[model samples]
Target: MSASPAPKSYAPWLLMLPALVMVVVFFGIPMAYMLRMSFNLHVDEKFYVPGFTFEHYAQLFANPLFTAAIWTTIKLAFAAALATVVIGYCFALIAWLKPPRWRFLLVGLALCPLLISEVAIIFGWWMFFPKNGLLSYALVSSGLITSKFSLMYTEFAAFVGLIYITLPYCFFIMLSVFDGIDKRTLEASADLGAGPFQTFVEVLLPLSRAGLAVAFSQAFIWAIGTYATPSALGPDTLWTVGYLIQDQMLNKHNWPMASAFSMILVAGVAVVMAVTRSFMAKRQAVHV
Candidate 1:
């Protein structure tokens, strides 16, 4: 007798169809609509009709305000990501170097911010940067400053807030990466007379490259999407892409312009993500 034929595998594809449909419907459709809208005109405080014009794109490209906003957004995001990664590395190293009894506690403390909401984090920083808040009060009490000096509505405050908001996520990523590293290697490096700095530069950093990339990308992406924290913490001139989109959508009543800004922001994020992924893949390949 002939052996029974093997069954075909169509069930997994069938199961995935709903998710595919949902993505196409929700994500793809909106993206395409926005892309189309970006080329259309938003005339005279009315509905966005389908007139194909490059006016919006031209205006966006020509406007110095948009250009400045893009630059500011990039600067803020990059700065915040870098700060978070640096602080997070130190935090993770502390957690890794500690005894097992203290390891979990250190990691848990690093991750507490991530457990809280963005609004809460913003509010906490808001309270801390003002004259009546903890930072200014501490400075006054400690005799560091003669009087209560507020940091609120400053670029420094915004940067601090952004770093604080993103540091927990960066710490957790680095901590997980650090956990995978063999402590024996550091000991061996020390046995070979390598200094702590030298060992970190030669061994720990190279191994943690992937984690740094991930943490940077995560923080940068989050910073790009954040508007409220910067708006609340910094000066009025601190206009990001997020703020631009929000203003266009709500304050200006220009949905098409808002869609255009949204598309640009998405494209900017995509480019950054692609570059980061490429760099990460190259590092991984080299390491492997």
Candidate 2:
């Protein structure tokens, strides 16, 4: 009998067809249309009309409000990502070092932020930061302050909210990295007369560097794309890229401008991801 024919290689692409179609329909088409409209007309503020001009793009950069918003967004994202990495690293280390029975519980707590809805989290902070909220109540009850004090509508609140929202994701990512590492490496370092700080700096940190980078990037990306928590918890001046997009589309009824803003945000995120992946790749190559 003749040998059986080899199996076809079309299976993977066939499986991916639906996702490919969804991506094209949802992402590609919308982006193309938005790009086209970015060069279109404002049409007396009533509607947009097709035109070929760079005036909109020019005006976007010319506007100081937009420029300041972009700066605020960058700062908030950087701060949040740094904070998340530090806090998540500690939390994940705790989870990793704990007994098996408590490990799951600790991880569950760290991941709770991701599981909760963004709106719910915002509401929780909204209640907690106000003059009549938990902080004020506690301080007043303990006589720490004669009058209620609130951190609401401040940059600090925004930072707290951003960190809280992104911490779980970073924690989970770092936790997985910590899990992959052998604890005996740390023990070995200690056995050789390395102190706790020295072992961490030499062994644990080196091994975990890639993970830390990944977590920071993840948190930063999320923080950059988020608008709700910042707007709700932060002061009126706390404008960000996502908030700008929302403003242009909804409040200003400027879809093309909103689309333009979105494209810029996407470009920013792509650059960050590219840079981070490049760093990770270089590190892996060096290690290998």
Candidate 3:
């Protein structure tokens, strides 16, 4: 007789036990709490009574400030995402075509913004845009302007800061996509008498459409959540949903409203992610 064979089991599940517990304890619990809080009624300045109510969500649409913030955030995010994609595509394409030595240098430069803290980046730009900052001083010193002029606290400043923060992500995403393309394809296009612009439009752009969609979605998602850079660099009137969430949670001590805003923001991001996934899936199916 032979020894009984060992029983088969899901031993691999043991490895995931800790991660499952952490997710439930951290993310799951907090999300459940926030969902409950979003329905509670606010009483006076400090207290919120437990209850089921839709007033918080209703007020979000009813209030002009919140409505305006929604529009502003979407517009800013879309603009920033589009600009980042265009510039990053150009930068990535150039870097991709360059020698290996130059590619490494360009990649390192692009990663600089990503490595630095957002607060640090905001402060650096803050100092660079003020009337007495490097930019104004340079223009004045160079006799390009009769008087120093600040670019600070303007829409242009906000857009610049947003683009700076989001550009590195777009660059890396597009670079990886560009790297996957065969160099011989471009050569073949050139052999067939295609100009540089023609090759890019006919060969490169079509191949990279999926990557462009992915990069744009990621950049837009990032921009939608970023409030610090824009708030610090742009004018006072530029209020984003993130800023409003902070204000409600800290300044006004309105937990219910804050929770509502956070839930809505999360929902918006989820919708964008779903759409992106569907788009990519369709593209993959078509290719197959």
* Candidate of highest lDDT: 3
TM-score of each: 0.90, 0.92, 0.91
Global lDDT of each candidate: 0.87, 0.89, 0.92
The predicted structure with the larger TM-score, 1 or 3, is 3
Model 2 score (lDDT): 0.89
Angstrom error of the Cα, residue 99, model 1: value is: 1.9
Q: How good is model 1 by TM-score?
A: 0.90
| Count of backbone clashes, every candidate in sequence | 0, 0, 0
Better of 1 and 2 by lDDT: 2
User: Looking at candidate 2, what is the lDDT of residue 66?
Assistant: 87
In candidate 1, position 205 carries an lDDT of: 92
- List all candidate RMSDs to the true structure: 3.1, 2.8, 3.5
Candidate 1: stretches off by over 4 Å: 1-26
Runs of candidate 2 with Cα error greater than 4 angstroms are 1-17
Mind giving the per-residue lDDT tens digits that candidate 3 earns over 160-208?
A: 9999999999999999999999999999999999999999899999899
Q: Give the per-residue lDDT digits (tens) of candidate 1, residues 1-288.
A: 996655557677779999999999999999998898877778787647678887777778799999899889889989999999999899899988999879988877877887888889888897898989998888888998988878899999889988988888898899889989999999999999999999999989998988899899899988878888898899998998888988988888787888888888888889888988899889978978
For TM-score, the strongest prediction is 2
